[model samples]
Target chain A: MLNQLLRKLIRSASGRTQWLLAVVGLSIALLLIFAAVQVQVNYNDLLHGKTNQDSVANFLVINKLLNNQTYGNATLSAAEIDDLKKQSFTEDVGILTPSRFKASVQSYSDRFPFYTDISFESVPAQFIDVNSKDWKWDEQSAFIPMIAPNMFLDFYNFQFSFSQNLPQLTQDVVKMIVFKVNINTPNGVVSMNGRVVGFSDRITSLLVPQEFMDWANQRYSINQDTKPSRVVMRTKDPGNPQLVEYLKGHNLVTDADKTRFSKYRQIVNTVVNISWITGAVMLLFALLIFTLFIQLTVSSCKDEIELLVTLGASPKQLQRFLMKQFFPANVFIVLITLLIVTGLQYWVYSILSQQNMFVSAFTSYYTLLTALLILLVLWITNRTTIRKYVVQQQK
Target chain B: MQIRLQNVVPVPLREKILQRKSEVWNTNIVFDQGHWIKIKAPSGTGKTTFIHTLYKIRNDYSGDVWWGNQNSREVTGDALAQIRQQKLSIIFQDLRLFGELTARENIELNRVLQEPFYEGAMIDEMAEQLGVTHILRQRAGLCSYGEQQRIAIIRSLMQPFDWLLMDEPFSHLDQENTRKAAALIADECSKRKAGFILMDLDEDDHFNYFKRVEL
Candidate 1:
């Protein structure tokens, strides 16, 4: 009842259109801030979330630049490999050990006259993308198994076979054919049967099982220096700008197509930063307008307030009354902006999903938390301004 | 509460008042609790100033005014407001009611400003007895001087208080209207065992005065 009479005496701060304009400004500011937070969350989810995980984008074969300074000795030293492992981008690293012996591959079948001086490489089992059971080899096994690169097969089918006037071979047919692997030692030529077991796109080299590679190197290694010149690693995001920057700083190279997101990352960072700064400045101005409005109201009703204080109304009551009038608008702005962002998020999710991009349809918790934090700031502003003006009237 | 004055003198009226003989100026006196007091003064004798000094509205006075043992000047701000709401009530000579509000609203303002001291119907009852019921719904600014005076009297009576300060509260009313208004004031004070210091320019038998002084 007292507040009703007080309300009649002190109407909502005089300028209605200005108040509405300020409210609109506050809403737009809140929307921009919310969009920045949601965009960041979506970008992070795309980079690391399992639903959008790209298997081929997580592993990379890293090697130093083969320039004049490192042409013959491009091998990563133990310290360099350890430093790469210690970097935040590299989740796991496996060195690619090259064959240490003289070797060649020749066809054992009479129908196919295929022979080539081929070198083999071996990597740890964790780094291999194919999971064939025949990938392991021992002296008792029927034939040695090798994992061939899909690029090699594509080249043979599309260009190599047409130029050489030879028949193209599919993966299944190639896997069935056996070949003889010859390793030259001090005594004589050692021969073993070999067959293609699987195909992979992650690595380009002909890969042999680690156990077989170790045995061959132990028995027939002539050039015994086996320092690895290449390494493969698994990471959360191959497109992370930090990873690209690290690679560039260390004079290393990887496939350009996989790290293509660095450009988009930089653009998104600029956009988010611009949105954040603009929103904060606008929010500051909106709050300033509100504070000035509150001051104007209190000053305009200065006589009435003095009479009220003279009539025994405490400053706390007036402060509470002013807060009740102003804070609800802020809360309403925050809620409406949140609803708009939610709608935009769902729309973005549907549009992106049609193109095979996966992102959450709901606003992320971090965005909600940021909204709550902004609301807290608004609440404090409302409380502080009301108290200051009301107490000023008292004085 | 006991009202004590310690060499109380209004600074603006100090020079002229010191040359004259007065009972309240530069004099120490204690008006006991529940005592009806009257301060009579001719025109331009600072009657309103004395009332305002007691109410602590203007503090350009020389000496201390105490409510019980607490000095009036020391009891300030919200504490003073609290005392005005719960311990002291007043009726200014100008009838300082909010002009925008109706006469009834003017009374209701005082009633609701604190934990209400009377039921809402008491307002209508007081308005009826004071002969201002017809103008209760009229704005105080639109009402006649007599009606506004009666409205101010009822408004002052709406709050609980130990002391009621009146400065020519019935000046604009007729003899009959003044009698009715005074009867109502006296009745309300008696009901609460409260007292009042009515400062007027002339003598009148408003109530059985416990003590009377010339200002």
Candidate 2:
């Protein structure tokens, strides 16, 4: 009953228009802040998520752009490889060690006589996309295992077979045949038996095991060039414009089709930054108006407060009463803004998923945490302001 | 509660009170528990100032006013509010009521300010006894001075107190109303074994005052 009467006395001092303005301003400020956080989370999910298109884009083969100034000397030094590993975009680098000797491969059967001069490259096992049980090589092994690129089979089946009037063979037919590999030594050509074990989709080269490449190169190498000309690295975002720009500035190149999201990423970054700035400014203004409104209400009820204190109303009572009136409105505004952001996030998820791009269907935890943090700030502001003005009125 | 006044005198009337003969000014006096006391003073004798000093509402006076073992000037903030809520109740000369509230609401506010000294029906019963039942729902600001004073009297009685301080509590009422109002005040005070300090201009055969002094 006393609270009801106190409410009557204090309500006449403040109007409804100022309260409505405060609620509206606070809602807009919170909405913008939460939207900025959600945008960042969505973009991060797209870059590192295990979706179909993004996984292939995460592993890029980078090499020097073969131009007139540097055609033959396009090899990457140890320092250059280390520098690539140190960049924020690149997670790991695997050098493609090219052969320094001449080699050739010939079919075992006279029915399909195929002979070709081919260069071999070896990379660390993690970068290879194909998995097979026979992908290991040692001195005691019976036959050398080789991984051929999928593009090599495609070219032979479509162009080479049509021109040479030869029949196209399937992968199982080719895998069953053992071929003769010849390495040119100082005395004569050394022969070894080898077979195709798997087909890789990433690097376009005949890949040998790292251990075999080490032993073969030491025994039969004729040249002194040890540096690799190409490298394959796993990256978090291939479409990051900074990564592309850094590569271009250093005269390096990657697949142009993979960096297609550079312009779109730049546009998204601008929108996030703009929203952050606007939210911060609006939050400041909203806090300012709320503080001024509270001060005005207290001052308008100055006479009534004095009489109340003189009549035995404690300062704590008035402070609690005033806090009860204002803090709930702030909580309500925050909840309403959260509801709006949730609806917008669901709509955005549907639209993005329609285009074969993947993002989370629900809002991220970081955005909810940001909203809670803002509510805490508002609570502190309300508490201190009420305590300050009520204490002043008591004196 | 024992109210001790040691050399208490209003600063603005310092010279005049010292020149004339007085009993409360610059005099050591104590009003013990459960004593009904009255002070009679003529014009410009600081009757309201004396009452204000006793209530600790103004400190623009010399010397000390103590309630029990603590000095009134030393009390402040919520402690002072504690004393006011639990020990002291007042009826001012101007009949200070929340004019925007109704007559019954003005009385009910004090009734529930602390723990209730009486139940919810006490307000209506008191208003009926004081002949303010017809104006119980009327705004206190729109009521006449007699009705407002009766509301203030009932408001003061709503709280438990060791001392009930009155400064011309019945100045605007008629002779019959004053008689009836004094009877209610005396009856309420005797029921709780509490005391009162009434300061006025003239003398009257009101309640049997336990102690009378000339201010």
Best by lDDT: 1
Distance from true location, Cα of A333 in model 1, Å:
1.6
| Docking quality category of candidate 1 according to DockQ thresholds | medium
Task: Count the clashes in each prediction.
Answer: 0, 0
| Top TM-score hit | 2
lDDT, candidate 2, A52-139, per-residue tens: 3557677788899899977888988888889889999889999988888899999888888889998899999999877889999998
TM-score of each: 0.89, 0.91
Interface RMSD of 1: 1.3
RMSD of each: 3.3, 2.8
lDDT of each residue in B1-215, candidate 2, tens digit only: 89999999899999999999889889999999899999998989999999888888789889899899999999988788888888999999998889999998888988888898999788888888889999999999999999999999999999999899999999999999998899989988988788999999988778899999999
Model 1: fnat (fraction of native contacts): 0.54
Determine which window of 10 residues in candidate 1 chain B has minimal summed lDDT: B73-82
| Candidate 1 residue-wise lDDT, B4-118, digit = tens | 9999989889998999999998999888878999999998889889988898888999989999999998887668878899888999998887888889888998999889999
For each candidate, what is the lDDT? 0.89, 0.88
**Model 2 score (lDDT):** 0.88
